[model samples]
Target: MEVHAHTHTPRKKWTHYFWEFLMLFLAVFCGFLAEYQLEHKIEKDKEKQYIHGLLEDLHEDTGTLSETINEFDGHLKRNDTLIKLLTSDAIKEHGSDLYYLGRRASRSVRLALHDFTIQQMKSSGGFRLIRNQKVSKAIIEYYNRTVFIDYLNGIESNESDEYRKMAIDIFHPVTFNGIVNPDNTIARPENNPPLLTYDSKTLLRLAGMVSYIRNTKQGLMKAEIEMKMAAIELIQLIKAEYHLN
Candidate 1:
C-alpha cells in the first residue's frame, strides 16, 4: 500500500504578521485623525458665526446710541431754557413758553439696546466659543456699561414723572393742550396764558425738578458716550482679531 506522506503548510513569518497589525493600526489612526480634524473645523466655524452675529448687534447698538445721544443733547438744551424760565420772575411773563415746555416735561427718549446676540451667548454658554480672553473681556465690559445706562434711564423717567406731577399742580391742562400744534410743535400763545397758581414756593419746587431731570440727562449722556466709545473699540478689536471686515 502506497501511503502519502503528511504535507505541512509553511508557518507565516513574524514580519508578515507585523505588517498586518501595522496596517490595521494605521487605518484606525487615520480615521481618528480625520474625525478630530472635522470636529475642530466645526468648532471654528461655529465660533465665526457667533462673532458675526455679535458684530451685527454691536453695529446696531452704536447707531442707536448715537441717535439717542443727539436727541438727549437737544432735549437737555430745552431743559436749560426751561430751567431759566422757571427760576426767574421772567417765567410769569413768558407764560406761553412756560406751558409749552411744561407739556413736554415728561417726554422720555429711551434707548433700547440691541442685546439679542449677547443674551443668546450668555444663556447658551456660547461665550466659551469666544476664545480670546481680551476680546471676551471687552465685550463683557461694553454690555456692563449698558446696564448702568439703563439704571440711569429709570431715574430719568422718574425725574420726568415727578416734574409732570408738579405740572398738574401748577399747569393749566387747557392752556397746555392749546399750545400744541398738529406737528407737536409749540406756537406762542395768541394771548397771555395763565397758570393755575403764582405761589413762589410752589413755582420754585417745580423748578427744582428741572435741575434733577437735567442732572439725570447729563449722567445718561456721559454714559452713552462712554458706551459708544467702547462699542467702537470693541468693533475694531474683534475685526482685528478675527480678520473680519
Candidate 2:
C-alpha cells in the first residue's frame, strides 16, 4: 500500500519552454546588431585616413609652386636693375660689354617667365577642386597667345635695337592725317620707335598674372586642407559617439 502511493512530479509547461527560446533568440540578435555597428565604424575610419593623405600631397605641390614663383620674381627684379644700368649714359660709353650683359639678362628673364607660366598651368590641374583639364588648357592657350604677341613685337630680347622699335609701334600707334596709324605701313622692323625696345612692361604684366595664378593655387590648396580637416573631425565625432577611439 505505501509503494502504490508514490507522488508524480508536475511536468514543465510548453508555454514556459517557448518563452525561454524567445529570450535566447533576442540575445543573439542584439549581439549581431552590435557587431554590425562596430564594423561600419571601422570602415569609415579607414576611408578618412585615405583622404587625409591625398590632402597632404596637394599641400606639398603647392609649396613647391610658391618657391618657384618667388625665385622667378627675384630674377625679374635683378634683370630690371641690369636694364637700368645698361640704359645709363656712363655704361653706354664704357663699352659693348654692359650692353651684352643687359641683353643676356633680358633673355634669361623671358625664358624664366615662360617656364613659370607653363609650370603653373600644369600644376593647376593637379589640385582636387581645380583639376579641370579643359579649363587648364584654355588658360594655357590664352597665355600662349599673349606671349606670342609679345615675342613678335620684339619684347622677347633686348639684343636688337631695330626690333625694339617695331614692338613699340605695335603697342602705340601714331596719328596720320586725323587717323591713328601704326608706325610702319607694313608693320616691318625698319620703321618703329626706340622706347619699345625693352621688355619691362611685358615682364610687369606677366608678373601680375603670375601673382593671380599663385593666389588661385593657394586657395585650392586651402580648400583641400579644410576638407581633410572636416573629415578628420567627423571621424573623431563618430568615435566619441560610439566610444571606439
Candidate that scores best on TM-score? 1
TM-score of 2: 0.29
> Clashing residue pairs in candidate 2, if any?
none
CA lDDT, candidate 1, residue 226: 89
Write one digit per residue (lDDT tens) for candidate 1, span 44-162. 88889889998999899999999999988987888888878877876678887877777766677788889898888889888888899999999988888978888998898888888
Q: What is the lDDT of candidate 1?
A: 0.86
Summarize candidate 2's per-residue lDDT along 153-196 as a digit string, tens digits.
34223333433333233233331111212551221222222332
How many residue pairs collide in each prediction?
0, 0
**What local lDDT score does residue 103 receive in model 2, on the 0 to 100 scale?**
30
Candidate 2 residue-pair clash tally: 0
